[model samples]
Target chain A: MKTKFTRPERRLLAASCAVPITAALCTNAGAMHIMEGFLPQGHAIAWGAVCLPFVVWGLIAMRKIVAQHRKAVLLLAMMGAYAFVLSALKRPSVTGSSSHPTGTGLGAVLFGPAPMAVLGMIVLLFQAILLAHGGLTTLGANTFSMAIAGPFVSFGVYRLCRKLKVNRLVSVGIACALGDLFTYCITAAQLALAHPGEQGVLASMAEFLGVFALTQIPLAIVEGILSAIVLMMLESFAKPELREIGFLQKEVVKA
Target chain B: MSKKQVVTILILVLLCAAILIFPLMTIRDSEFGGADGQAEEVIAQIDPDYTPWAENILEPPGGETESLLFCLQTALGAIVIGFGFGYLVARKKYRAEEAV
Candidate 1:
């Protein structure tokens, strides 16, 4: 209700409708934010249903976090802000198109995927309302891919990497980059599933994956480096905050 | 920042810049469109009659407004992140001075 397209935007939306059957002929090369009214009603509702539980869990986790450490509120806001700033930028890709970074990885690594589900959802909601980039109808599907699935993957990878005794920064970097890639992968799978066409889901998935692979790989690397830099900055200036979230060891804290 | 941290961050910055710039240099006059539109096209191709059953509630009047909205989103996010970092740095300094 809060987000819709203007007439001119609808026309531009229609203008983009006249696209090549294959991705190669896409003249309006753009980022991967699913636009308004793109997903069918059933798919939209199903995705929304899938996201609801995660989002609810995120809110509960957020409450527990605040109860544990009041200062974590700032870190939480920072993570949400981090996600928005990164996601908003449409970086150029080798495919000669652009797509955004999910930006949820850092938060997932720091605070776990649950809170990020809430933060990422807020960012997606804002993008839908203000930018008309992603639509409300497809919000569930988009949120599931970017927020729920991606953050879970990021958090899991971060834990696994740390368990494997990889360097902290390197682990976080890998986790974040993989999270971004995973978001796009889920998006492709979701789209392919909803529109299997004549060739079926597997073939459609391959086609969708091909569309995103070249562009996303480089973007993922960029995301990893950027996330690592942010982690370093936080380490230098925000030790107490990091400690609050259990990201920094007790030895790292100033006496 | 320590020299090592500074150098590392600088190298990372350069790496990100190069990665983004490479695409622009190689692809002359490419539209660099969003992947979402391509997916939409694929959906349409797979099923020509699949009309989107829903519509966005609010669309910017034109392209300029859309750009403006996007800038606004980034600006808001940047401000919050900046404030968060600034607050943390100042708090550290305050604690140090208190100890002294």
Candidate 2:
């Protein structure tokens, strides 16, 4: 860290963080991706099949990162833990609408979308089995939306912003926010397809979108800002690790 | 933490508070519910006959148990990130001293 925190300062930081976390605990676990056994059998199987290739790719990518970068092992663990923390912290928003942040965006930005596939799959698996939240049957569909779709969006936004030479934090924030928004969009689409409304699939999608997208906008921004703060912390204390991981090239992050 | 980072973090805390509280203030008679359930409601609206056939092999006993498991997930996550960060910071600090 650039500065060592005093006892009081640490307390203040913890107190500030405690507010949202405590609120999260009080809220119902409602905003998780398509719940247990929600999808029809064929749709469920299809979604799972679709996610198979990505999960395999992610396993390979993660193994490569672990085998190649001993120093970066800690970074990898931090990223996984970060995804666990954020997804578990569901935020309630406007008009009693509640949703959760997919912390995968930060990992996608730091590493790449590929490794996030494995981490996200594991998180969803645990949520399904232990919490009885998002179901095992719908795992494939949920994984596709939260893991593959979200991370890809984040990685794309991040790469685009970096290519444009935008400020580092801005890149991280925009990428993560958009990535978070996209996850729900896919979820809405998945639900729409499974149960098309009277008007049609498009109408059904719009209905699902209406429920999720509006509330997600602000939550997405919140995820973005929080992610940028984490990146800032990493840069301060884990400069060597970041550099070794090729996240901070000689002038890439320099203002 | 550095002054800039601390300030940024505090701003985040305040912003999150606003996001959570604004709805309660503006919208009345709102049942703050989960989006997943809302989506399911939409599904029911579309296909009234359809019922979710698959079941969780191990359902958490109740909402409380579910909450407990969620909290456990959070705790495990916190510990991993905390230990990873502490180790990295300590390695940097002590390694700097050794180089000096």
Candidate 3:
């Protein structure tokens, strides 16, 4: 088999390979977002039901992207892998919550939040079934928090930053960081609702948020920076593909 | 380096430093845990009678082995997905060129 890759393509491949290895080295073993069977059956079912519509919409959006731009098929898959690897790289934080980059921000920015719905769900499923990181029953709750909520925040923040005419890389960083923080907030809310203290759901939510903030804030900043770096690499090496996927405007690519 | 490159580097360094320093300064002895475990603990504290409605289908033998399996799974998934996407994209690019 004669496979000739362009210089940029080769570099992209090398970078992609290096990312997971380095991330693995940096990771620590810890519990993730919501463990298996953590949520009550009603909450889990309700959350899963909530995610169904988004997942369906995501499937439609992904299909359209694939049909319109054949080149994007691979990028979508790579985005899924990137999210998996990044989320798995857990850094111990001052708070009990082990911290890691959500990695949804980049995908949401590149592919839009809809496609991320599908990608995130798949990643969660793999984590649950293969690594035992999450549980099948709690899949819905995890998916709702990490996949659905995180991506939407990321996409929204990116759009908002662009509207404000922020620096592209800085915008990406902020969006990713905000998205990470938002995911934890939602997770806290979910946990509080499921198991409200004597003080009530509002009080419990506040407690969870406070506990998470000690770790999540710094983690979010790290995630934002990492996502910006990844985006910069893509802009440099995968400009053509980014243009094809409509992530980079033609004028910007030309410049 | 370009201004953008310099800014990017600076941000990365500052964030890395903050992540490392904050933990050392505030809570040097805190046992880092996952949100899930912490949530579970809080739930227990809040309502001792609360019982989990579900259980994991399988539990890993130990924490070290569990981490090993997770690392393996993630690495394998990354390679397969990455290669598959790369192949598809390369094929599309090649086919387009061949037609032209």
> What TM-scores does chain A show, candidate by candidate in order?
0.84, 0.85, 0.83
What is candidate 2's lDDT per residue for A111-182, written digit by digit as tens? 888788889988998888887778887887888888899999998998899789888899999999999999
| Full candidate order by DockQ, most accurate first | 1, 2, 3
Sorting all predicted structures by TM-score, with the top scorer first, yields 1, 2, 3
* Model 2 CA deviation exceeding 4 Å by range: A1-32, A250-255, B97-100
Span of 10 residues, lowest total lDDT, candidate 3 chain B? B91-100
Residue-pair clashes per prediction, in order, are: 16, 0, 1
Error of 3 at A239 (Å): 1.1
lDDT (Cα, tens digit) per residue for candidate 3, span A9-118 = 45654554453344433221111277776777666766776666566667667767777778777677778877887788777676645766677878898888878878
Per-residue alpha-carbon lDDT of model 3 for B1-100, expressed as tens digits? 2588768677787877688567767776666667666767887888788886666666777888789877975796579656864654465566665322
lDDT of 1 by residue, A42-79 (tens): 66766776666566667667877787779888988989
Kept native contacts, fraction for each prediction: 0.74, 0.73, 0.48
C-alpha RMSD (angstroms) for model 3: 11.3
Inter-residue clash pairs, candidate 3: A96-B33
Candidate 2: deviation at residue B64, Å? 1.6
TM-score, each model?
0.87, 0.87, 0.80
Where does candidate 2 clash, by residue pair?
none
